[model samples]
Target chain A: MLKDKKNYKLIVVEDNIGDFILFEEYLNEKIENPTLFHFERFKDLNDFQDKITPDFDIIFLDLSLPDKNGLDLIIEVQKISKQIPIIVLTGYSDESFATTSLALGISDYLLKDDLNSTTLYKSIIYNIERNKNLVKIRESEQLYSDLFQLSPLPICVYDIETLLFIDVNEAAVNLYGHSHSEFLNLKVDDIFHDEEIDKTEEIASKIMTHKKKNGEIIFVDSRSNTITFNGKKAKIILSNDITKSLNHIREIELQNQKLKEIAWKQSHIVRVPLSQILGLTQLILDDKETTQETKELIIILNNSAKELDKIIQEIITKSKEISLNE
Target chain B: MKHLFIIDDDAVSVLILKKMLSNADFLETPMVFYNGNEALNFFSKNYTSVDTYCVFLDINMPVMNGWEFLDNIQTTIHPNNFMVYLLTSSTSEYEKSKSNDYHCIKKFISKPISKEILNEIKEVFNSI
Candidate 1:
């Protein structure tokens, strides 16, 4: 199939001029308009550093360069070829050195004896594509790690079967009063108050009290989800500290209890005196009273006492309803 | 006619009730006790038939309250023979609902009892 006309930039960091020509010959067979930049030594590449833009797709590094060689050369080349794929070309067929060179971030280790158009062409295409995928994977991993570590709320991953914490973010270490290593040694139950687990559903998120490593119990609204962590079934817990809010609710409840007690006393204590006033007035009205003026005064006194009683009753009833609702 | 009893600590309440019953011309004189303990002592000695006695019970006395009196009375005699009316200062809904649990308690009346209510109580006893 005919491919799209694309400009390909390549760098050959080989000191041997004959090997550089052989690489160009192989690359020319597969690629069209391959811009080749040849640097004979590590010092030569250092001088060309300012020109080392990201436009270069791949770097063909000769391990035995004039200034640098072996693993040292591969590391130095990596500094300039950030996202570019680097293929190590060597006259030696030493498998151990090639393995070591690959470990130092060289994309592929190619032998000079196996230099053919098809072999070089395949290595270039495969390593470039593979490097692209590796870069993408690293970026996504960095994004996830940044989100986890920099979150304001505490977050942790714990092995579901053992309940042991697999990982804890910075906020979790601060909130739970445990170092990362200390948290890894603890189970989920160890970080929670006994009553907290009793009130919480095993599979659902809830608000409950948690015990820190230093023995301080705090309220936290937490969510837990089943997840896979390093190939093990684990749970991710996200928690927001709610101790202050819970304390506020407790304080309000205490105030409400005192209010209820006062309302209770109003129902009983206040009515005692009021009942006496009513009884005394009734006795006066029944008395073969001596005068009409005395009767009228008693009638007014009785009505006032009844009105006061009604007001106290209304207050007590309303408060009782409030307490009952709670 | 059934014998009437008033168990109360307050002097004015007992005095007012006496005058009201008299104004209504109730036949039997009500036997009065200052506290629930005194009423319980009287019932322990004199309790013979529930149908023959009617009590106007009060709460909040020094020796024993109305609830204790009710509890004590139930243990000593048959629950059906006596008719109890709670006549007290408490207008609390809690106490009112609690009074329903006692089958022997025929009515709950918050004081002060009028002559009309006294006549009505007399008519109820007459009908029974």
Candidate 2:
């Protein structure tokens, strides 16, 4: 009979000729003009492992091969065709072992006694589609995990109920001075100052103090949100260190106070001597016993003192304005 | 009608001011105190009259400063009993502006107290 053409490349690993013939007959009923590759020994499939370009759509593996059988054979075949869906056909009727094989990454497990065309066809189609979805889910999960782990800011995930740390990024480890294993042993309260830990649950973001592993307290700007982590209700915290900025502001305020004190002294101290000069010069000038030339010299001296006083006044006035602004 | 007073530590400043007051024909002998503490002490002991006194109060003094004297006097006597004129060689705009905070401080006078200033003071008291 001329087989109808519905091209699908398939691989079958079987030591038994009888089972091989039966599987081919069953596949022929469903698939038309299928390219089927058969390997009698497990070692024979290993020879063709590097030869295949893309891969076969499905692999029917007989667990009881000449060299390798059961879980070991499934593992070996799975290593070569990591992305391809694998179905295990075995003569053993042990349902427990069949279940064990499925857990070990085999897509489907069928006994040779119960194998039929319809059952064989259905297992191949369903498992291939299922494997595709699983691969997509795994890739997406990797993408999200990479985003969290590789973040630049210090971040951590902690269980909401237990308040225990579930995971922390590299940045968090370096910032808090705690190793990954050490952090796993710590609760959320361990990093926060005693008074501030209670507020973490109440507020989403705030500036607060935190303690590092070395028992140093630092100011931090913390932002947090609730999220599901490893199937547990947890909170993710992103914190930025602000200790340096706070210290900078404190330094500026201290400098401003010092400057104000200097200005106040300038306005007061300089005037003491200037007052003496003015008072003395005026007394000398108003004296009737003084000559005209001596009086002119005293007047010039008085003008110089007054000019110096004006400059000091301008400084005091500017400093006062600065103090008022503060 | 106003009484005249001079509160200054400098004897030369006191002499010059007293002469200016005599020239201005101020009738009273013009009560004098060397420093802010002495001035505050005099006011504490004496009965302050209803009539205002024109006081040429010097700023920088040994016992107590002008600002301290003003603070003490605010609680001790009525604000209207004194017409305070702050006298200083300091051309500081800061202290000048600060004088406005005391309502009793009528004027900020930078020394040397000339005849024109004495006449201005006379006119101000006469007008009041």
Candidate 3:
């Protein structure tokens, strides 16, 4: 009842006037006040293509036109229809051809012998709904494709069985110093250093040593997951270069080792002589036979020795705090 | 009677300890050994449990070190008869902590032994 109240805009392209009139009657039985455009030949539709807008919901194309028909007519109509759904009207003899036409982007195919108000109306309603869903799926797929192409971190997809590269993004091409075509020819193990190539099977979220085309060895934090790519079982790897930071950590560790060695020397080797100086000076200052002038100089000497001892103590304490991390 | 012993390689440090002991009026004349080996030899020959012994032990020496001396003496000597004071010039917390492992070691003293330190030693000796 609700479908009978809706106005449907339809385009009918047929060489025979009788078939066009039958399609119009079937459409009118379901849709009230339907706007129908009739084109006698494929050229007539081509000529009126500029006036065709997206608001025209469906196009009923006859497979056997006078000048153009079959796949050529379907393609030309689709080029003009754009988002509009097209249903092919064919004979019983062209039934197999009409079914194959669906693979070439035809929305639905109906035999002219099976022509009835109910079947014709059902094809129009079903295809228009299916076309809208197809458009949504295509847009979302394009969005994901754009995300893969424009990513900053180096990403690559490789076939899991052959271990060969299937696809690589722009960042991966630049990082590996390989052209896009060169990367496709290489296996995933080709980028790894010889010692690390054997461990490639377990490369999920691990730091591995890799070699570039220029023979520069680098460290990469690689994270990978299994994904089906282009109908093949594949793995997608995201690589983060961490060579500079790891080298910086090693340099700091070496400096801390030197500092620890200095601390040990200050506590043991340097403190021994200073202890003797302090002891001998204290003995002089305590002697009853020593002159006042000599005792005064000995007191001054003792103070200087104590000050040097304090400085050495502070050095040892500060160096002991030098840990590997900080 | 109480006996005093000084075991150190440094001559100046030993002289200062001996002077400080006399200045503190510690009655017994303290015996001296150049290293832990000399001290161990003396103890093996003349050790008597009848008299209480006080030892001033230095850590670093040529033939035998302070830790080796303590390890060797533990089996031969009774801890009650001997009170050992460890003296070292090195300011290492590791050595100080390690000294706690020896039961006969009475005190850990940092070097350039002062008059007040000797007096503290005399007080602990007399009380014991």
Candidate 4:
């Protein structure tokens, strides 16, 4: 009663009519209105491959076909089936050959004599579910692989014990000036500066010096973590080049130091004589014995000195502002 | 008795201060020293708890600067007996703020010392 409610789309590739009919009866017994496409020869299946779509749920592949048989038939059918689960149907009870077919990516291998509706139905359901999970796992693996390969920052995987470079992304290849194969041959210590190799364990998230293939030295902010890569204990390092930024900061500091020196000179040295001039002029104007004309001229001189002091003060303030900005 | 002292390297600055003090009609004629070491020597010999001493001190001198003078005399001088006026041509906020560290330093005066500043100093001495 439960089988009558379901409809299954199936493809059968068998040269034997009796075997094909037997498969059809077994499928119909389990799935009441099963949609079957029976191809008597492998050539006929190959010819109709262009019309094959993912709508076909399960493929019942005959291990022995008139035009193609054994491993060749399985491989060709798999090419057409794509994501669809294939159950190898055979008359022989060869256990070793069954294991080999499964290794070749067949979803399941079943003997034709032992094949009943219940057995066929169970095999179809199990293989389809397993193939769906396999597809999902493959997709997840591809996504992770893409992330590693396409990242902009230079990344490398090295074996923890030997420190040999196991894998490197395209960015790492470009940055280190080493080809992919060349990097594999070199150890992590080879890229590090001779002095820095001794301190590699303490290199996480710290700026360290590295050497390129051409012997050019670079500063990099390195971060790393342990990972089991290809069954080997390894460490993955992501190196961010910080040479330009560090140099930029140093340049700014030097400029600030120069500015501070200039400010000090302005405040201490330049203002001394100016203050004397102001003092001298004030004393002259205050002198009771000095003539009126001389007194007027001294007032003008004092005002000019005051103006000059104001300009010097402005210069000191501006220099401080510039240094602060840096 | 009240005593006035001018501790500065520049002769012209000392002359200007002395003239300004005279014009302000200060009674005591100030003693002059070229540097902090000279002033420190004078204080070591002449220091008395009874006498009120007002010092016009300049910061950037050749030997023993104003800071050195303050550090040398900080323990010896009583705050009530001595009043230090920091007179400097250096327009530095850092030096002004740094002057606050000395308890003997009463006021920071930017040079050249004006008639108003002299009158203010005279008032502090007059009050004592």
Clashing pairs in 4: none
lDDT of 4 by residue, A64-107 (tens): 77788888777888888867888888766665687799889888
| The best candidate in terms of TM-score | 1
**Candidate 1's DockQ:** 0.59
Q: For candidate 2, what is the lDDT?
A: 0.82
Mind giving the per-residue lDDT tens digits that candidate 1 earns over B1-128? 47899999988788878877877777889999999999999999988863477899998889899999999889876656588889988888888999999988888888877667777878987777
Give the candidate order by descending DockQ: 4, 1, 3, 2
What tens-digit string does per-residue lDDT give for candidate 3 at A1-326?
A: 65576768888888898888788777777888888889998889999989998888899889999999888888778888866888888999999999999899888989999899889888888888897899899999988987887788899999988889999988888888988899999988888885444433546677888888898998999888888999998889888888999999999888878888889889877898898899889878888999999999999999999999999999877876774336
Q: Candidate 1, residue A63: CA error in Å?
A: 1.7
lDDT, candidate 1, equals 0.84
User: Second chain of candidate 4: TM-score?
Assistant: 0.97
Give candidate 1's chain B TM-score. 0.92
| Fnat across every predicted model, in order | 0.72, 0.38, 0.75, 0.84
Q: Report clash pairs, candidate 1.
A: B50-B81, B50-B82
What does the lDDT read for residue A197 in candidate 2?
61
Please report, as a residue range, the 10-residue window in candidate 3 chain B with the lowest summed lDDT: B12-21
Cα-based lDDT at residue A188, candidate 3: 87
lDDT of 4 at B110: 86
Q: For candidate 1, lDDT tens digit of each residue in A1-326?
A: 34324688888899888888888888777777688889999988878877888667888888887788877777777887766888888776666698787777778978998889888878877887898899899999999998998898899888878888899999999999999999889888888787545312344667877888889999999887778889998888898999999899999999999998888778777787788899889878877853889999999999999999999989988997887898
Model 1 sits at a Cα RMSD from the real structure of 5.0
Q: Model 3 off-target regions past 4 Å?
A: A1-152, A170-185, A190-204, A211-217, A317-326, B1-12, B18-53, B60-65, B68-73, B122-128
